[model samples]
Target: MRSKARTQILFFLAASAGVTMFGMYHVLEALGYIAPPRPFGDSIGTVAFGVDIALGVLALALLPSAIHHDPMEVEYGYVGPPSALVACLVILSVWMVSVLAAPAGAIVLISLSARLSLYWTVPAVCASLMSALVYQLTHSPADPNISWSTVLGSVVLTLVLIAMGSVRGLVLRRQAERAKQAKQARQAQSPQQTQSAG
Candidate 1:
């Protein structure tokens, strides 16, 4: 697949994930105690989605370049310092700001996007937490113990996200490599020779 197409696929995936998150939020809302994680208009949801989609796109764009070439090869990939790393930090910062500053409608925009990193981070944390929960469950008595079902479900979800990230990363890398190879071939072509005999 082309790098651009791979990026588009990832961008689409992130949007779909956002939709899934929204559904979960609604289900929780129906329970009466759950408010929007980041309420739109009043919260950071708008900016969140924007940031998320932006980051995913940016990463997708840059990530492909990085796969086949070194920092020197990928113009976007910086060698001296980790720009993607820094962007992750910025993503988190802006997300917090969006969550605090935006109104309810705008909240959804950046709120979800802001958590883009969490697709990688949150699941790691959640999976670890789930493991601990499971361990505790084993030791506790059946009557007053934590919910095994909930722990197991959360663990399964977390693992799935981790697997998804791995797949996405691999796909992006492969696409990037192919793009790099094609560019190299095009660059390798020598200019046409001109001979004049008088």
Candidate 2:
């Protein structure tokens, strides 16, 4: 159990680091700190970008599995509103710092809400709203008009990613349930067989 916990913590840390690096890279690029690829290096740049995106997606997808509680440890009940509220606050705080931190905030919320409950939707919605709010606040008035499409896209993407995490949680929950039922059936059969033999 100790070894398993250590492995989970390590996996969570690694995924978090990868996600942070991926988010920061794009933030820097958006701020013009990282130049676009030159004509000669375009293909190379595209490949690198694709790899980064793949890593980011993989990290997000694995996050629920990495942090999921053991079936025996999980309490079978709905998580209350307070838990959802705290998750929303955490995501809001992260987004307040920078809209570019949306991915990081999503990760935090997803990890928090990835369980067999409806609580995931609360933080998911909050994160999406915060993304749009931060974008509006950060956009300069003098800059070209705010692109509503960009805001909408961000909101949609945030919801989609978090929904994916929720789905993962649901799948894990179902598998655990099936395993528990099978174990119970085996135990029942064993007792009956012993009685018949005696």
Candidate 3:
């Protein structure tokens, strides 16, 4: 249990650091603190962003399992649910992180809420609102008016991702329940067989 806890803490710390660094890199590049790659160009950056989002999704999706001390002890019907205070802290943390890494942070929030059996809509709505707010705040006065279509697209994308994450969480929970049942059945039969043999 100590080892498992240590592993979980280390994994979370590493993931958080990786996401933060990636986010800061993009922010720096945008601010001209870091130069964009000349040869590979923005394509490489796009690919990297996609990969980061993918990894964030995978990590958040598997977070519930990671939190468990033992899968067999999962009695919450799905994944282990966080306390209200923890949930609030998570939401606030994601919101703050999204300011720098919107896509990855938004997806992480959505997946985390879904996996924890919370109202996924809360994070989805929060993500969409945050995206729009960021866009408005960041929009240059010299640039053309804010594009409503882009904002709408972002909202739609957030919703779709939330839906997908929710579905994935549901599937994972069902699988875990099935595995738990099977293990219990085997354990149940073992004692009966031993008694009969004795």
Candidate 4:
């Protein structure tokens, strides 16, 4: 598959995972096994969450267009570092607000043509902290004797899944890059061959 399609597929899968995690956390919380997480700031905080959701939705909408159009095709202010910064901030804000809604959005931004220079390692670290914070802040164990094994296991499992996804995504990206280079090479050769034949 083309890189664009692969990216879309990965985003969809990641989004599903995020939503599932959010749902599971809520269910577990209701069952008294986990603590209840709160919204942003109470009443106004909900607006921030709304913004987060909106940004995610926007990213989803933009990914398809990114496939066909060069993200840098625009004039001044339309592409570059500023845009990348905005994209990252929007994604990070989404994660800050709702854990389950950030994946697809983040992936969308990453796949864009903005050419963000930020390394993925930093965000990976942030993700680790985000998950841990959510778990700790929302703990609601009825028994004080409960061990942290379950939490640790869940975290480890999540990391493993993320690693697998990242590897898969990287493979897809490399294939796409190679394909692009091959096509360019062929185009370059075709004109020379035509001239020589003429």
Candidate 5:
């Protein structure tokens, strides 16, 4: 059970990191630092900034899970119902995969998920669809040569995910070993206890 919890935490952390990187890429785009880039309109740039902060906060929220045994044991309680949780996971998963396909829309998905209101789920879904549509409309023919900064950002993001995964794997392994040892000790003591009782 503990190991299962640890695995969840690790996956959460990796997802958060991936989303944050996606968000940062948007931030950079808004700041006029990258390619296939557009002039930063005030409204969209502000939205992008808000999206970046929201993602960073989401990432920070997972910090407690790193130290605590069970994330659900936290005081605030779980995010929402199992269905909502599943939706968020699905949304996040799709965005993570988008890093390879449509990197532009990754931030949109994270921003939508951060809203977290059950009522907003449908709107968020629609917004994501619209955002992707706009992105595709803007850049239909994909460029083979992406900006160097964008390339560097992707590499860094990949490294962060890789490192987090390694740590999470180690935690799960240790948890399994401990559980196995405890089980073996219990088995070893059972025969002795039985003999003494006899």
Candidate 6:
């Protein structure tokens, strides 16, 4: 798709997700399920929603550059697709390791891709671990109920997010590769065409 069209679609999706999350935050507050952000009259959480929207918009704006200057496409070919799929597996693995490991190694290594998948998976892993710790500590020390179902569901969510991110990166990478290859072909054929014309 053309850059403008892709930008519009991305912006729309981002706006939709922002609106939904923002609404959920409010609904949680209204139901007294989630405590609001602190301070006399501050709405930090709501502001965070706006920030998310803004970041999405910014990303949509920068999408062209990301496509045009993609390193994975230029240097490694269509690495994005496999990289994206690997990302999902990594997210699930990281979460599991984070929960079970005394000192997690996945988190440290995954940090290298903070710009790709770690940005969200990192926080999800932290939240899951923190939640598990709370649940483990609150119950009888010997008979803690860190429900397997809850952990499984969280792991699944992170895995899905990772997949989505990977696919997105792959799409951009493919575009960059196509552009680069086409540029090279034009350069290669130019000399042959000139020789033939002479």
Query: lDDT of each structure?
Result: 0.40, 0.55, 0.53, 0.49, 0.45, 0.45
Could you tally the backbone clashes for each prediction? Answer: 32, 0, 0, 2, 0, 1
Better of 3 and 6 by TM-score: 3
Reference-based TM-score, model 1: 0.36
Question: How high a TM-score does candidate 4 get?
Answer: 0.45
Q: Report the C-alpha lDDT of model 5 over 29-141, residue by residue, as the tens digit.
A: 65768652244356655654564455444533433332223334222233334443444434433332233223322433332233333453455454444434443333323
The number of clashing residue pairs in model 5 is 0
What is the clash tally of candidate 3?
A: 0
Clashes by residue pair, model 4: 35-138, 35-140
Q: Write the per-residue lDDT of candidate 3 for residues 1-198, one digit (tens) a residue.
A: 115776466446646765687678779977999754433456655755564465455544444343333343246653433442243334323432233334334445444545645554574466456646554444332444666777677667666766786786667668778988999999999999999999
Report each candidate's C-alpha RMSD, comma-separated, in the order given: 11.7, 9.0, 9.1, 7.7, 10.8, 10.7
What tens-digit string does per-residue lDDT give for candidate 4 at 162-182?
Answer: 555456546655765687789
Question: In model 1, which runs have C-alpha deviations exceeding 4 angstroms?
Answer: 1-123, 126-144, 191-198
Higher-lDDT candidate of 1 and 5: 5
Q: Tell me the lDDT of model 1 at 33.
A: 62
Ranking of models by TM-score:
2, 3, 4, 6, 5, 1
Candidate 4 vs candidate 5: which has greater TM-score? 4
lDDT of 1 by residue, 49-165 (tens): 454445434433343222221334233342223343343333332221222111211212222222234443553344345444633443233335676676566555445544554
Each prediction's TM-score versus the true structure: 0.36, 0.58, 0.52, 0.45, 0.37, 0.41
Regions of model 6 farther than 4 Å from truth: 1-16, 28-73, 77-148
lDDT per residue, candidate 6, 1-198, as tens digits? 225675455445534554465467568876889754343234555564454345334433433333222244335423234443333333333323222221122222232233254444465466545544453443233455566676677556545544655666567558767988999999999999999999
What is the TM-score of candidate 2? Answer: 0.58
Q: Point out where model 3 deviates above 4 Å.
A: 1-73, 77-100, 116-120, 141-145
Candidate 4 stretches with Cα past 4 Å from truth are 1-118, 141-147
- Displacement of residue 189 (Cα, Å) in model 2 is 1.5
